[model samples]
Target: MGAQGCREDGRPETVLEGWFVLLLDLEAFAPRERVDAFHHAMTDSSVPNEIVHEECDAGMSARIEGWRVGALDLFDMRCSGLEVRRTARHVRQHRDRPVVSVSLQTQGIHRAEQAGTRSTLGPEDICVFHELAPRTYGWSGHGASQAVTVDMEHLGLPVDTVVRASGRLRASPVHDLLLGHLRSLFRDPGRLEADPGAGALANATTDLVRALLTSAAHDERDGRVREAMGSSLVPRIMAYARRHLTDPDLGPERIAAEHAVSKRQLYVVLGRAGIRLEQWLIGERLEAACRLLVSPHHAALPVSAVAARCGFSSPSHFTRRFRAAYGTTPSEWRRHRIRSIC
Candidate 1:
């Protein structure tokens, strides 16, 4: 029988008829060796991953065991701290089909980014990402997760609905059920492999996932956290805020006029997202100023210039807000970050 994750020619083929366990280990190798090996494995499996280690010197390890269930791939994996990206290059390279990966974060905080949308999944949080789309993924120091990859069209899912709810499944009854189902299927592949009902099991697992996604979509239609932040309209709202962040006149009235909405309606939507427009604008300006202060691109810009560029009318006010928000002066933050990076 062939291995589970390894493809003879960079694509998964159904060789092991029943459910089987395929393990990829990177323990014996050095840090650099392990990183490169993992990258190759991911590409060979058609995952299209690009990993970046925050600490290049840190040793890393990973053990990924995957089960082939019909057209779906169920996997349990654990890895050291690193940032993984699925870029357009890889997507274009693996032009066969887009893989849908739904992961349950088991150990640490898993931060995932799709396009420009970002979400963080804590312990037991089930988040999904599209493998063909451009994405960035990272975890705190070390993390472990269990995931299933299936073709989006294979499941006949509503593409637009699932796209909006990506990376935002909180714990609920349906989610718990789905998690238990996956845990049973992947955690004990040998038992499942022996069973004659492997095909039935795979079908049931897919059905449970569809039901869970339906529940999430229903909840989000009422304006869940994901909709408030990652919905179709949120990007435009964010873009306008960013473009005008340096304008002292940027406020609720300005946002309302630009977006062609009444100031009252704007507040209602922003308030639903648990944000006040005035406070959010101020926060954005402060964050922008901080980024400039610490960034090499703006390294030469003086603190006063940064404050002015970030819509601050007074340097003292900016300093006070920055200190209050970050518990340090802008200059102190820049100096500390520079020293650490160096």
Candidate 2:
């Protein structure tokens, strides 16, 4: 095994029954030799790319350990502050061998940008990147992460779908499940690779990647539909509220749950249209109470009955609001309307 399967620092590559391991530790090399050796090791392991460092000194050190199981390649990398860019030129070169990488930040901050979306991830937060597109990923201070890279063909997803899913992984139900699985895999890759079911495990992992991408794409489309319907959403909410005006439990929380939105989001949509929910609700209930008070069909009903019909739990509260709104009490308003009609 040349530099491809063997280690660059002269250590023998650890090979299990069904795995190919690559280990590179820059600590063994002299400070001056570490930087150049790191670049070579990175380029040789996966893709052709550029690695840049702002400052290099005795403090700079990098280590990479990877295990290849079938088409899945798992890598754990820890390094000082540095940046890596897979530019358009690099994308063109690697166009024939497309791959998707899902990374989980383990320490420090990891900043990644791809397909016009950028993310700053903390520990346990996951992000996706693909070799088919240009991306910039790096960290400041000390950073460490474990990533699993698989061929796009194995995932059986369209490149555009993968790109869209990269920024929206949490939308998929399998996100947490996949994250936990990857964490377990990285925890004991040695034991896992030696298992007789390693090939089946690889297939299951591929299926999960495909599922995550497909579900996330569906969710993004659904989100777009919701966004497009924003103009009608407020009207819908208002109509629902009106229909349920007699319910004593009706409020922002209930309305939001009925419409599949957050209470804050409901307020935001209504606020954009200059509608205050609480005030609007009160105004609507008061209007209903007035109609009931004046209608001949409801002439036998008392003021308190009208208030209850309009969803006011407290008759005194309705009296106060009615007096404030109409400049008279409910009884006085009803009497005035009756005399005017006669």
Candidate 3:
């Protein structure tokens, strides 16, 4: 519960961690409905996976705590022993984009493998892996792990660079720097969700990852790293967009001006990430609204206020979009989770 309370001056009133999204908890599902519930919760709430639990009848439990740092998806997950995999078939069937993960084992034993490389990552040890390539997350006993996921294309490193670094333990000082921020950030992701400086914190988080990976896998002889970093435009746009998500003027034109680019350039950059600008904006706003609906800090606010807080100019429009995205109106969704929120 390190995630709430702020001064009227809009500064942290206590050492409380920032608020976060509670993705899922197995205990919330009925025992008879747990399997499909977990599967859907994991696949739809986070990444898609083919899971093999140790015992179906056993009370397998998990809680997925997560937040977004711009384009990166940060997750802190604890669970009973299980084997999880993402393979070519799963990727093809879902049309999964090429996403990658940088993770640390927070508890118990964890083994991971991808692209013919394998590593046994322990607490404070870091490892990297990706979708569209075979990867496995397994443990013989209950454990937890925290990860930051970003698309391979958005990483600003050559695919070969990430491919080579996959399943390898990073022991350098750079690894230490990466893990330090990750641990600190995960401890209070709520800050990034509610603080006015959320955008800065999120960008700093992404920058640390980019630096660690670039230094770890970069080959100075090819001059590709510089080229890649210069050409990576999506992160910049996302940083601007995430910061101003609640701004009524937030849109392609304003964002483009903020980044010193044309509206066309903005679209081109987002297009490279394979998501239209408007679609991405709506999706992010809906996600923000959904988070506020269930979060304690914002729970006292009216649903209309939450929509405005997330930048929707019209409460009715926000309601329609929220229902479409989550299959329930904002009020119903909030009421549905009253027990958990309280």
Candidate 4:
């Protein structure tokens, strides 16, 4: 089938390569019930389902809830699945692709092992792993639990970078961000299409994955330095730009002033990252305008209104820039997007 073929289940057979998302809900089921539901979902979805009842035993229990979001390259053909078991079992063979699984427990304790290292994950705590490698996971039914699987390729992260940042297992705030975004995506796919900042949302997911992997593979001292001086700055700048996207005066001078950094220093920071500050700001504003242009909430608003909301003062200028960035004029893009959604 072609990459765009749609399945009967409403999921496209082959999602676009850049990024795709999945959201699952398990609030209706308890811990054991949730695992059972997962087992059924896997088997029903054509995933491997070699259930070994002997491996089932009481471990730690907890409640699980949240979202998982990341970029995906559909052409990669790397498969991943989520499963829960009470006891850790040794497996001889695993998938060939790297896999990172993150989980949150409301009631129990969970332990995962890889490369001779073991880590226990507690309630609200997360665990990550490479599925292609050998590993063992054990948990007790102390309460309900939830987990998600991310194929390394879909994560839009470099394997060596991730290994260096986190290695086989580690935890960070990025994991929580990923989970939360995933949950939100699942809860309302429409919001993704309607969100004025959808592009940023997508970019954030990919960026977070990259950051997590980089942190894992690097040394602790270096990682701390990067996090303190380098890592946090980008997001702050991004947030500042997004908030004032519609302000005509929201240029580098104002941005630098707000952050208490010299314009030269701000430029240096962005330049070192190989991105032009002005171009980045323009791209962000255009993306926000695109969202409003297509959003049902603001669909009744005039095209010029949308452009103005995104800081575009001249209609012609906005049209030119929007077309240059997205390859479609604002009106055409909105029409096409609306048709797709309907």
Candidate 5:
């Protein structure tokens, strides 16, 4: 089945199933004015908007804020008469940042132009645009359209490769995958945040987006997809380390035993990622200590108390490491951070 025909309720399956979660928090902005304010805020932050009201449909029957959280930000937007004019003023607005925004039309029709390429997207059709460059968008018709927007920052993967791999138009496989992922995210907004598989699903979505964007930017294909999958073990290892950071015996030996792997193998895996087991443990300890230091509940606690909670046996050692990592003693950093916040 084509990507467009796939439903979010899992009626027809697609290859890019576990891509994103759709989070719709209407209660977050209850008042109509608050919703209008949010809409204006979004337009100011990213695009310029001129919303016109029509009797055919209220400007927006439902106000939605769609968030696609992977390593990057994938935004799903459903709204009415959402028109954007990307003029020289817009480019000057963003400076020289390389930003890419991809939108898949789930319901209305959209006309978009970028880099002299113009595309009209019907339902299930997708469009890609660079934020730093000049572009314009217009949507018309009776129904609202749902679009997925990916920011350039979250796409840690290359861009040229993604474009090439997905094609430049309506008949591209990469485009299909992106459209399918967006559909899934929209169909199941609750699963992204509440599901146990959300983390893995988010990571995979990031990889796929990175791959697609990289292919788009470059005409070449790299092994980023494979590498992202292979390095997926890092999250599990990090989780284990974080959970056991306070344990004195939470060293390489314990980690290996817990994972049913040899100490050397554990080291090898971490080493491949350019991290030493001891250093990684120390980093975790320092992070934990930092958190405790800044926490208001622990503000009255002594430095030693904070250090012990974070698995530092000797206050002096903890102080030394903390200073080395943060360029200040724990107490000083904590005091400064809290005071600044206040």
Candidate 6:
């Protein structure tokens, strides 16, 4: 939420957490038609699975809404008595992006089976499972859950650490914190996603999940977890800075303030990662300007406009730096790129 307000470049506000794109209301479908439609939606949704429930009763219904938040996908799901299976076959058939699924049970009973372990979760209970592994999950009656799927690599933990933590999340001190966050997120998904700082919020959520896993696995002795935890700040800072690159005032003081660090501390973190803060910022700004110069949509804009959009306040200064970096002026670079494409 510390991110800058509205952009001045006139681009539409960036929606960090994308709008929910998958919406299904199966209650209106005929009893016989509901299962197939639900099955199709299940297969097509962000997480692919095989719908195995055999009954097609009149009361059966399912509604799922999914939102994308950076490296995470969140689903608000409600259904009446159904099972979904994700076998090794399903794993192979779908895209091979390994992820971990965290589910917060809010209504009815949710049953999950994975790695020879079966768990029955009631309201306010949480469960975690690896998406690439063979698993079966569903409920026997009407149930609702808020599920978040995050790319495994983003956790910065080894596979064994995650596997160990998955079945024992409550052992972690931060489990309730993560649970409460998911609850609040799903309460008004659209409104929250629309917030300007939703991207940073999502990143914070991912960090909390990582911390929870590290604590649950009792991985303080494990150097991988310890090192990952220690070294995460650099990436976090870089991401924050990149998001604000369009702001001319995105300097050390502003960045340090947003991250709750002193300007000196910010420099120390990036310095440890071999980054020269001023040069890095300039490089990123130049790179952004280069992309805009060659982009078809921005081609009509003058070189000065392109420089201004990328945070440069002086057109002549932008040209000099652009030429120094790319061996040509911005206008020349854009013309060359257009000619090459044609």
Clash count list over all predictions? 0, 0, 5, 34, 22, 0
Candidate 4, 24-95: lDDT as tens digits = 233333545545544454343323434332223542122212222333211101112223332233233334
**Pick by lDDT: 4 or 6, better one:** 6
Higher lDDT: candidate 2 or 4?
A: 2
- Error (Å) of candidate 1 at residue 11 is 15
Report the poorest 10 consecutive residues by lDDT, candidate 2: 11-20
Q: Tens digits of per-residue lDDT for model 5 on 200-229?
A: 666655555554454445433346534543
How much is the lDDT of residue 159 in candidate 2?
A: 79
Clashing pairs in 6: none
lDDT of 2 by residue, 182-254 (tens): 7767866866667785776676666666666666766535654334234346645665677678776789999
Predicted model with the maximum lDDT: 2
TM-score of 5: 0.46
Cα-based lDDT at residue 330, candidate 3: 93
What would the TM-scores of all predictions be?
A: 0.54, 0.59, 0.57, 0.44, 0.46, 0.59
TM-score-best of 2 and 5: 2
Deviation of model 6 at 323, angstroms: 51
lDDT of 1 by residue, 197-259 (tens): 667556555555665565565663554423332332333454456666788888888888865
What overall lDDT goes with each candidate model?
A: 0.68, 0.77, 0.70, 0.54, 0.59, 0.73
Lowest lDDT block of 10, candidate 5:
1-10
Residue-pair clash count for candidate 5:
22
Alpha-carbon runs more than 4 Å astray in model 5: 1-39, 44-62, 68-76, 95-99, 157-172, 216-342
Error of 5 at 199 (Å): 3.3
Ranking by lDDT: 2, 6, 3, 1, 5, 4
